[model samples]
Target: MQMHQTARNDLLLDVRNLETHFFGEDSVTRALGGISFQVKKGETLGVVGESGCGKSVTALSILRLLPKVSARTVGGEVRFHGRDLLDLSDREMRKIRGDQIAMIFQEPMTSLNPVYTVGRQIAEAVQIHTKASRSAAMKKAEEMLRLVRIADPERRVNNYPHEMSGGMRQRAMIAMALACSPELLIADEPTTALDVTIQAQILRLIVDLKERTGTAVMFITHDLGVVAETCQRVIVMYAGRIVEQANVIDLFARPAHPYTQGLMRSVPDRRRGRQRRLPEIPGIVPSLREPIVGCSFAPRCPFAIDICREKRPPFLDVGSSHAAACWRAEEVMGA
Candidate 1:
């Protein structure tokens, strides 16, 4: 796939043909199948798809954070600033991981430690990454809390994870992730658990932080609306592969892949009066254990033809920096 064409200097991350799998006793689940994309400096790249589309796996693979017992990165390279992370030793990868490339998970409750105060956790990251004393790191932690727009940052820093509200805890998580001023941040549905108002607040905080720090962001979410508001470019993944990618404006205006089109149609239109049913894509996602022939989404695609069932389509460039992995890309775009 011709996944990226980033200039040498502007690119911060270039993930190429990454494949990750989970090995059980009798079965192997292909979680990521040759997914490729690039994140430029100070850019926000959105990866949108339904559940089980390998969005989380891709993030985990990049950080080499998957459980050693079951998950294994079988093939492909994750290039971060021209260095292949997969080739790095565990000790080397650990140094790069929070200090250079950080991640904010979906649930702050699970990610944060109940035993320690929020400030201590953030300070720990700073101390590990830099040669700062405990007191200095703790002060930096308070600064991080204030940077994220948390109220009473001095007092809030001393509070435990369970003591804060959901929004506060999420903001704390962001502060912890941004403690070291990472070059690239992977936010996996960071606002998924927040209320609409809180979600907007967190989104704004992330955007503002990105602008202030010039850090590239890899935003992984199923919310197209969130993508519209935050991302400059977006890639639509389906069944472990990128089915389409384009600029956010072009993607929303003219989605070239069948899956992308279905996702766009599924969004509710408030202008249309109350409807009996909102549009939905039919059929459940197929299991990854099953051998997939041709296109993985062919069975669920409305535009699937004989060739779609028999042969997998290549990722074809559809113009204007857009690409789609579909046999009927021209027909779908009405070109």
Candidate 2:
């Protein structure tokens, strides 16, 4: 995988020092802990991490959709098109959401309304964002469904969500997301609930849509293979913070963070001779209730040193547009 230079001026969204916290029974859980990254126009940025690593939370924060009573965006900035989304009013944010930014969630069954026909759902989005009438919106919805490669979209649009298969439902969700031709799309584990074949189809559809619409995407998932196939760059997160950021090729070839290396090794490879057991990263993720004293990954990092345990590592630039937050990044690369 050869690294290519991304057009720096094409950056569409830049998130800086974002922090989202949840108030629980007795403590506050920091879901997004000072995370930062950028998604360029017409490029896909994949975010990979284990469950509960703030992948979904980060996506929700960008839309300002977190439950206000229990969760709040504590700090940081989410800039889209040189405007800070955090400063926008609720009404303004609502207009931006689904019009400028749309999201395709992991589960289409739950995300889609059970009582409404797929066509009606997509038409609703179109009508809300654009000045299209009922008949016009429905026509646009049908076109979008066909665009997502759904067969007999006109008929399918009339069918309720429960009548469609998991794959078809996912495609319907995608059609709804693209109803307004949004500038940015956030897909959180879009294919997680589907089979392998369906997952591949969904990934291909997203790539095709990006190529055709020049829509920037923030694809959140734990599957590295999917990232390799779909994303231009990768952001590795752990304990709510981004630990490494690099172009897809470089990150896969020479991962900078020890935790990232561990994750790569843990992926089962048939090329390797049969092993007694798959590799596993030791230790559980640290509790986010209390403020972390040092690097959150230090507890599980095999090459962690005294310095790593005593202080948080700054995101160090290793090369052009490649960076990692690890004290022993060089040593990890060597290994």
Candidate 3:
């Protein structure tokens, strides 16, 4: 993959050849197969792929929040602020998890503690990370609620997650995640469940907050439309590895990878006639448990050749900063 020179000095998070796996009694699942990417300061980078394509795993790996019993980071480095996070002690990682790096999970309902008021939960995080007094922490929590544009924050902060509407609860989650002014925020499909209007509002709120705080963001989602709108650069993942990476504009204009092209075609086009059916990718993602010698996406690729099915392709730069993991990328893109 092509490494931009600017990333050498500007990146806030640099993940290099990171690999992760989940072990069971009888089988092992390769959750992340040598994934690499960088998130520059105050920039939003999108990681898009179908479900089970290692998007969430990459996030969890960066934070070292994977399940202790089954999952392990086998190789590579996750460097943040020039320090390799994989070398940090548990106590050390604890300090950075919320203070410098935070994550907003997909579902607020399941993530927020059901028994405690939202205020208490956010306050507790502040106290734990900053050593603030309980009263001071609560005050900060209310300010965070207001920052997220929650109405009547003074009263709403006291409401439990279940007491608030879905959008409000999601806002509260964002409030908690940003309470410490993290330099890097990993948002995993933060707006996937919201209504269209609410989704737009949340996206706007995130973009606004990032601008105000100058915080870099790694936004993970399967939505291409969201990527085009929210991210400056996009990484298209497939079968636990990245197949393409490029600036959003270039990617939309010319997707070099077959998988990336297929994803773009699958997006519903309002410009087309009303009776038209959106194009669909031919096959489901392969199970990670099965060994793949060739390109993992070859089974579904329309232009797959004999070599494509027999040998894995290296991720190579096609032109400029655009990179793709297909042997025939030039032909596919030009066609």
Per-residue CA lDDT of model 1 for 118-144, tens digit only, reads 999999999999999999999999999
Cα-based TM-score, every candidate: 0.96, 0.96, 0.95
Writing each residue's lDDT as its tens digit, candidate 3 over 118-155 gives 99999999999988999999999999999999999999
C-alpha positional error of residue 226 in candidate 2 after TM-score superposition, expressed in Å: 0.9
Candidate 3 accuracy as lDDT: 0.93
Q: Candidate 3's error at 239, in angstroms?
A: 0.4
Give the lowest summed-lDDT range of ten residues in model 3: 1-10
Residue runs of model 2 more than 4 Å from their true location after superposition: 1-9
For each candidate in the order shown, give its overall lDDT on alpha carbons: 0.93, 0.92, 0.93
